[model samples]
Every structure is written in structure tokens, then in C-alpha cells.
Target: MLGRTAATPVNGHSANNNPNQLALPVNLPPGQQSEASIVHQHIQEISNKRISTLDYLRKAHEGRVYWFNTLLFDKSDLARMPYFDSRRLARRATNHLFLGLSLPSVIDVGSCTPLEFLRSLNILLSEYDAFQQLHAEHGSASSSLSRARLPQMFRRSAPGSKVRRTSNAAEVGYPHDGGDGGGANGTHNNSETTAGSTLGGGGGGGGGNGAAAGSAAATASAISLAASETELLPGEEYTHLLTPSIPFEPDYFETFATLCDVLIDTYQRLLTLVPTPRECAGNGVAELFTKADGKLRKIIIQGTVKEFEDASRQGVKTEVANVAKVVLGGLIST
Candidate 1:
């Protein structure tokens, strides 16, 4: 085959040159090798941090979905109570506000690209659709039912019962221009005046006086009963209801606790791979170290908060309180 490709040179060098004359493979110095290793380590550290950040985001999103299911979807009887419906609406609004505020923070720290961000938002929207399905299925149609009764209910009642109707003209005197103030009857058109004068200028004096006294007495009794019942106001009851009970949702707590454990484990692994400052200096890996450090700190903070939130949901008030104390201490120290 073309004289065996001209009997190709063994080392691809001129046949005249000695075998020893062939260039030797370059050997990196120990320092350079160390530097390379450090660079590799730093890269691994950053990659690990990025992975952990993604895990955090995924866990947080999952926790949000679980929270929605536990708080809103699970309570079948919640729709029966008007107060609960109002509370649910308020809770939904509050959750939306918190999520909107916190989501940007997570995205910023994670450095999520636009497509990734949109994907996360889409997941949230899908979760929201599920939440709305629960709401629609359970929500009271009181407003619609109330509206249907409006016309007949608003119709004036016959002369009887608690709410009495009186013409505004009779209540506050209006000038009558017609002579004698009489209609077709021989009777005086001053029927209202006659009734008022006969009662010593008090149309329903006796009955009105008794009703007022009874209302005052009843009000006083109600006040006393309420005072004796509890020192808390109705609004206070609502506030307390919003405060999650300790050991609240055991399953929710367990789920987030597992997530926290994963974060801690990942963080430890990342720490092991981090390059020292000296190592970082020689290999241009210093920036990665700094980034990893920042990300680690953020992960710790967010993980702690998530743990606390889960604990609170499970009615582990002590843990929640401890977390709050830690946060306060951090703020104070800072």
C-alpha cells in the first residue's frame, strides 16, 4: 500500500536523530501540581454549593406545597365556618406576600437564570392551581345565597315585631300645604299629630321606654358574661388561631427536618472540598472560595429558618421559640 506509507518513522522524528534526542514529557513541579489540585478543589466546592442551592430551592418549593395541603386542602370542615373562610383568605394573602418577598432573595443567592426562574414560578403557579381547586370545592356560597334572599327580605314588614317602620315625614315634622291637612275622609289629615299628642308627645312612649331599659340591661349582662368568659377579644382569638400550635403538623415537620439534614450533609461535604486561602491564591480559585463561603452562610440561615418553620407547624413551639431567639441573637450581635 504505497510502500507501507514510506515505512513511517518510529517516533515521528528524523531517522538521523538518536532515540535519546527525542523531547521528554514535561513534568509539573510539586507547587504547580498543588496549585492545580487547589483549583480543582475550589471548582468542586463551587459546584457542590450550586447543587446544594438547587436542593434547598427544591425542598423549599416542596415544603410550600405540603404547607398548602396541610393548612388549606386538608380541612374539609373549614368551609362551614364564616370566620374560617375569612381567615383562609387572609392566610392566603399573607402567604403570597411572604413568598413573593422571599422568592427573589432565594433566586438572587442561587443566581438562577431567567428560564430557571420562570420554571420555578411555573411550579408555584401549578401548586396555586391545586390550592384554588381545594378552595373552590370547599368555599361557602353564602354571598350568592344571601343575594338571592335580598328582594323579599328587604320588603317592608307588616306592623309587628322588632324593627318598626315609620315615615320620615312623621318622624320629623314636614309642612303640609293643603288646607285642613285632610284627605277624602272627614277626619283630620293630622293622624300622625293626633297619635303623637295622645301619647303626651311620645308616639310609642311606654313600649319604647321599656325596650330601651331592657336593651341596656341585656347589654350590661352581655358585657359581664363576656368579661367573665375570657379576657381575650374576638380579634385576639383570631390572632391566636393564626399562631401555629406546637407539634402542629408532625408529617410536615418530619419532611422539612429531613431537608435540613440533607442541607447539613451537603454543607459538610462542600466544606471538605473547599480550598484553603493559600491554595486559592496560587490557582486563581480565591473568587470561588469567597462565593462558596457566601452561599454556605446563606444556606445555613435559610435552612435554620425552614427547620423552625417546620417545627412550628408541628406544634414544636419550644424549637420555634429557640430559633426565634437565635435569629434575635444574630441580629443583636450583628
Candidate 2:
């Protein structure tokens, strides 16, 4: 109540239009519930400020999209042109980042454990498989495909404004240094080497005594063969995950968009618990609210601007402009 009393209301049209601006929890639709939404409700309830995860993400999505579009988008590619103008990819990526950082639906944020991360990862891996299938079938040339459904991303760096593989992919850096496969407890590697064996029996025994003994021997032999089928070395059980070496379509950015959706759904369900900050009352659920709320904290990027830009890159200047706007929120053009 004290925090609520100290909070001042933001009176822009953004605030005035929403009826739940004053409510602790924005009313959910008929029988619908979202854990991320609930966490946001608590933040608004405690902050005495008109803050909502939904609202915050909207602003962030706007910024993220602006930056992505400004940096990516092939002017000559007519099919991709609409997608670039639409800016849906930015929103989609922001959603995944937020979900990945938040607590899941059924569980509270505090309950997030190492096991939960693995579960979340498994879901994303499944998403990767599905995305690959879709691209394999129709390619990014499919008219129905959205920008958010792409397989690759337009990173901030590189030789020109070319798109690159995101970290979520198995071979993020084109040529993978395959010293070790997935050791993390997420999923199995590129091949699920399941071993099986069979047993054989002979009918040579003519009498009762010989028949029973022959059957026993045959069964023993069958068991021995089955045991030799697949023998994994020590600690190899959890280390093997199938990392599919799927090549990317020309429009991989669009592919990344689709795959990111799968990751968003899975990650949004996980709950990561951290100690409550002093300014905000402990929601008790331990989600990293800051991560969920902040925008432009991208995961699929690396290197500096100078390191990645080259003579052929025409869009680096525009990319710089987009980043400047993100910092200023449409303030200046220097």
C-alpha cells in the first residue's frame, strides 16, 4: 500500500486507453491464465507505477523491430520486402527473449530448477526439428511464411549486413569446432543410436528330456546376443545429443523467426528465481523480471561493429541509425 501511494500515474494516451491501468491484475479472458502475465501483474501491484510486462514488451518490441528492420531487409528482394516493412520479426524475437528469461505458466518462478531448464531446452530442440522440416518442404519462398518464422538472423556484426546462424542453432558459426557434442542435460545428439538384438532356437531335440535342455540353451544364447547389442562407455549416456547439420535456406532470417516462436513458448514456461530487488516488493516468484521487461538484449549476436563491417556492406550506416534510435527511443539522428 505504501509503494502504491508513492507511485505516480503516467497520463499519456498509452495509459488512458487501458481500463486496467489502475487494477492490480489485468483481468484475464474467459478461463485463460498466463504465468508471465501474472508476474507482470505483481510488478505493477508493487511498483505503484503503471508497469505491465505486456505493455513493456510492446514498447520493447517496437524498438527491437525498428532496429532489426533497419539493419536487415533486402531492398531488391520483393518477397522479403513486405516482411521487412512489417517488423513482425522483431516482436517475435523479443517474445522469445522474454519467455526464455521468465517463469513458466503452471509453475511459479521460484520453482525453476536445473531440470526445468533441460525441459525447456528439449521443447526448443523439438521446435528446431519442426522448423527444419518446414523449410525443407517449402523453403522460405513459401508465400504463407512470416518473417518471424525464419531460420537465421541478421546479426549486428559481420562482413556487410548478411544474416547469420543464431546461438540456438547447433552450428552457429558455420564451421563448427566439434571437439565435444552437447554435454548439457538438454537433449540427445545428432544420432539416437538405439541398439537391439534377437535370439534363435533350434528344434533338433526329439524327446522330452533333450527338448527342455535344448530350449534352455537356446534361451541363454539369445540373452547373450541381446546384451552385446549396444554397450555405451561410462558417462556417455547423457553426453550424446543429435545435433542436426541442416543447411539454411537463402531466407534463413525468416526461418529463425518461426523457430524462435517454439523457443518462446518453451522458455516462457520456465521460472528462474533470483533474490528480490529492494525497490520492488518480493513477488515471491523468482523470475528475472528485468530480463523479461528490457528490450534489445539480443542473444544471437557477437563481435564489434568495426570487426564485422566490410567494404561491401551498404546497410551499416542505417544499422547504426537504428541502434541510436533504440538508445534514444526515436530522439536523434546522429
Candidate 3:
């Protein structure tokens, strides 16, 4: 038999023809290996894709807003755009479709539906109800004195009444005990004692702790009564008193605080939909329409959530922040 050369295959077949033949190995320099590894790492990084809910919503909103802004600047372009019902849009939904697939960048939204909206609304409403309950309790508890004084206040304000208008008028000023200074002083001293007991009774036995707790509750009631007597309404001042002056053993105004937090989170999330000034300036054709109830069928940027919120932050701090807060807070958490 003929001797095989270095280029010959082990079996009598050429390297290309032999299935068992292995390809020659090429050794790369350390530098080249590192470069190759880096290239591969970059490729892997580029292939991996993920997006946050906020970013997704923002992109969808941006697309929608840009689309609208474009339409606002051009009239003839409407003939080229697709038409849909106004009620079909879901701001948070993927592609803004209330019940359909993604349309396009401008008209399409990410995955969100009416169910999500309802769930969010339920949570917000529940929180709001809890807040209302807590607020009512706080108000009723604190307003006992005010309600008590209502009779005296009404009597004084009655037409042609003999009650003097003095701030210290016995009829109106100290109406708790028939306007007796001694009675007022006695009640005041009793309140002080109760408050002192509540505060100073900390280092006591179990029974003493029980007594202290009772005294604390009594003190809160009495102080609230006194504040009410002084015309301190259920407002920021009252809430302030409740915060540090009284221990929040029962979570204090935590419901209200929670509502506020919820409102803030909702607003921040909504801000994601606010188009950049640049986006607002673009122009395009429009074909989107809302359910026909009022004017011609088409989308319009009427009073938005921002406008509603701006109008709602005008009153007492202890109360609700804004209408948008309540409505939007109930619609979305994130």
C-alpha cells in the first residue's frame, strides 16, 4: 500500500470527503481572544431587551401625543389617516386599544386593559373610603366641643338675642358649664391632670400601663374637645395637633397620608404621558375620533388631567389634594 502523506485522511478519503475528519484548529493571540470575547459580550448585551412599565407607558403616550400633535398642524392629512371611535382609546392600554391588537406607533399601546383600570380604580376607591372613615372619626372626635358649642353659637347669633358678642361672653365663650369661670377652670385642671397622667405614667406596671392608656385616650378626647371649643376646626391645624401632640397609637391620620401618597404616585405616573414641548409642536394628519355625543367626530386635547390637578390643589392641606388625584389615583397605582 502507498504511504499516506500529511495532507491525506486517516481512512483513504480526502479530508473534505471524510465525515470523521476534523478541521484544523487556528490559535488566536491573547489580545485577539480578549477582543473577540468583548465583541461577543456586546452582541449578547445588544440582544437582551427589557423595558419598565413606566418607560413603556411613556413611549406609548409619546407616540400618541406625537401623532396627535402632527395631526393638529395639518388639515388635508386627515384623508390619509385611519378613523376610529374615541371610546376605543385606552390611555394606559397597549397601543391604546380598548379591545384590539396594536395599530401603529402613534395609535398602538402596550399591554394594559380595562380590567387593569378597574382594578386600579377599586384600590383607590377603597383607600379613599378608608380615608373618609378615618377622617370622619378624627373630625367627629375632635369636633365634639365645636358641636357642643353650636347651641351657644346659634343662640348668640340669633336675631335680637341678649347674648353679648364679646369673645369672652359667658353665653358664647364658656358655654360648657353655664359660663361659670370656676367650672371652666375646674374642667381645665381636670384635663391637665388627665394629660399629665397619660404622659408621665409611662414607667408603670401592667395595670398602670392600662390606666395610662385609658388616660391617654381621655386626654385626647378632652384636648380635642377643648380645641373644638376654641373653634379649631378639622383642618391642618387640627391634623398638626393630632400628629405630635397626640401619639398616633391608632395610626393617626395614616389613611389620609396614604391617600396623599397614592395621589402623588398616580400624578407622577400620569406625568409620563405629558408630551415633551418638542413633541407638542409637531404636525400630522388625524383620523382618530371619540364617540359621537357633542361635536364632529375627532380627538381633541381638551382639559387634561394636568388641568384638573392644577385646579384641585387650591384648598386645605389636610383635605383632598385634587380631583385628578382622587379619580386618577383610583385608576392606576404605577
Best candidate, TM-score-wise?
2
lDDT of every predicted structure (CA atoms): 0.36, 0.31, 0.27
Better of 1 and 3 by TM-score: 1
TM-score-based ranking, best first?
A: 2, 1, 3
Output the lDDT of residue 276, model 3.
24
List TM-score per model, in order.
0.23, 0.23, 0.20
Residues 1-334, candidate 1, lDDT per residue (tens digit)?
Answer: 5433433333233422422212211234567657656665765656576566546544543444343333321233323434334434343333233223334433443322222332343343343333233222122213443234323322322223222221122324423333122332212212332333443443233223445434433433322221111112122222101121111112322343353454445435434433332223243344444543454444334544464355436544555778899999999999
Query: Model 3: residues >4 Å from true position, as ranges?
Result: 1-114, 130-198, 202-217, 220-246, 249-264, 268-334
Clashing residue pairs, backbone N/CA/C < 3 A, model 1: 245-315, 246-315, 246-316, 247-314, 247-315, 247-316, 248-314, 248-315, 249-313, 249-314
| Error of model 3, residue 244, in angstroms | 16
Tens-digit lDDT track of model 2 for 1-334: 7545433243221323333433322343333334435554564443322223223323322334222233432324322333333233333333233233332331333234323344444443344333333332222324234234433321111211222222223224322222133122122121110101112211111113334434444543323221111112222122112222222212334334443443344334332221122112223332443332222122221111221232114456666778887989755654
Model 1 is weakest, by summed lDDT over 10 consecutive residues, at 239-248
Better of 1 and 2 by TM-score: 2
- Residue 48 in model 2: shift from native, Å? 20
lDDT of 3 by residue, 1-334 (tens): 2223323442232444422222221234466445544543432332121112223223323333222222221223222223211211111111111111101211223213222222333333333233222223223323454445444521212211232211232223222332123221222222223344456532122222445545655655534332222332233231101111111122212222232233334333322322121111111101000111011101111222232223223223323456668878888975
